[model samples]
Target: MTTLPDSFLSLPIAHRGYHDAGSGIIENTRAAFRAAIEAGYGIELDVQLSADGHAMVFHDYEMSRLTGETGPIRTRNRDALTRIILKNTDETIPALPEILSLIAGRVPLLIEAKDQDGAMGPDIGPLEQSVADALKDYAGPVAVMSFNPHSVIRLAALAPNVPRGLVTCHFPAEHWQLLNEKTRTRLRAIPDYMRAGASFISHRHDDLANPRISELRAAGASIICWTVRSFEAEIEARKLADNITFEGYRAAVGTG
Candidate 1:
């Protein structure tokens, strides 16, 4: 297993590195990422391929939700992708490698594999391999996680010891105990996640601070909550889990 950085394992992550500055630069852009690094928070960003197979920093499969582009991200070339103005900022889409280099040794990164409409996981291996290859000699901590746990298990075959987090939503109240043999069969083999080396559990904000979270922590799983937008949510989330994933890293982060 790769030795994570000293403060790497215990720090909160800024989701897409604090992009909403009312400046037009949306999440996953170079401006946002730079803001994150400068703020000294760990980074968590997503990746998808351009039309020509270049891995670029982006979170969703379609730009319609975040960027107002009605097409899939993969349909556009790098230049084409970069040309779309970020929601508020003058910045354009950013290349993953460029973002990586900008962060340098500043903080840990969680790179998520993304595809439009959730139909093309099989095509992710090469993209996964390419991203991993790019970060091979990276001195800072790095990990790849997906909401599709199968992709994580698949990536395991090629990249061993790379930490993966099981990204889930609306986690059941009984997340720690293994019950219901049927759902167990269909689920991503969560035990396999622990067995394979998932150091963290990333769940929605609502799921934090529950008994199940305590249970997972008892099992040595690091609990991380997602997209904390408000000060109240941030305070409460910090009380429940080991780390939090926030989208608004733009504000001066104090205490919790």
Candidate 2:
């Protein structure tokens, strides 16, 4: 297995590129990624496949939250997505390759392959394939992770040289009802990560107290927490996980 660079564990990861939409550095935009690079912090970003099979650096499955547009992100091609401004800001949606080129290995990146589309079993989804293709030629300190174990498994098979991780936690109340009992049980325990041969765990910050996470950490697996927003949460994360993926506060320098 390819080991992740030490910087990925030591430096705090800027969730969505140290973004501040109020300041026009919208999440996943080039400006946000540039800010993260300037701050000398690692970055954690999301990726989804576009209609034209291009990989895009975006978060929501829909464009409504970030952009005023009302449609699935994959409905628009890369050019059309680029034309849509993010939240009335000057920043437009960026492609994965564009952001990767902008970073140029300056800082490690944790790319979350969003798997909203049910990507169960062995078949690789288009998003996963697109992500693999985009990263194929890039020589950067990067890792791929996903809430869906299948995505991680697919990437592990496709890009064995790159580290892969499983993002796991108990589902929120709103999403809990959508999952069947078996799936919920599996996610709650995160047993699929082991089955998928994941090298790291990007767990929900609060859920690090679980015994499974401690076991993984004991076995020398990398453990990272997400969405760390406050100093208190950072303190807790420092205690349980190796690094943090943070946003909404001073995550770039660990002041928050």
lDDT of 1 by residue, 72-163 (tens): 88889888988887665677788777887888868788887763324323445656666666677776678777765556666566566676
What TM-score fits each model? 0.80, 0.93
lDDT of 1 at 127: 60
Clashing pairs in 2: none
At residue 62, candidate 1 shows an lDDT of 77
Q: Which stretches of candidate 1 lie over 4 Å from their true place?
A: 1-6, 66-68, 115-123, 171-191, 209-211, 249-256
How far out, in Å, is residue 129 in model 1?
1.9
Model 1 residue 71 CA deviation in Å: 0.8
- For candidate 2, lDDT tens digit of each residue in 65-156? 99889989989999998888888687788888888889988889999988755533444478788888888989879999998888888888
Error of 2 at 70 (Å): 0.6
Model 2 lDDT at residue 152 = 85
- Highest TM-score model number: 2
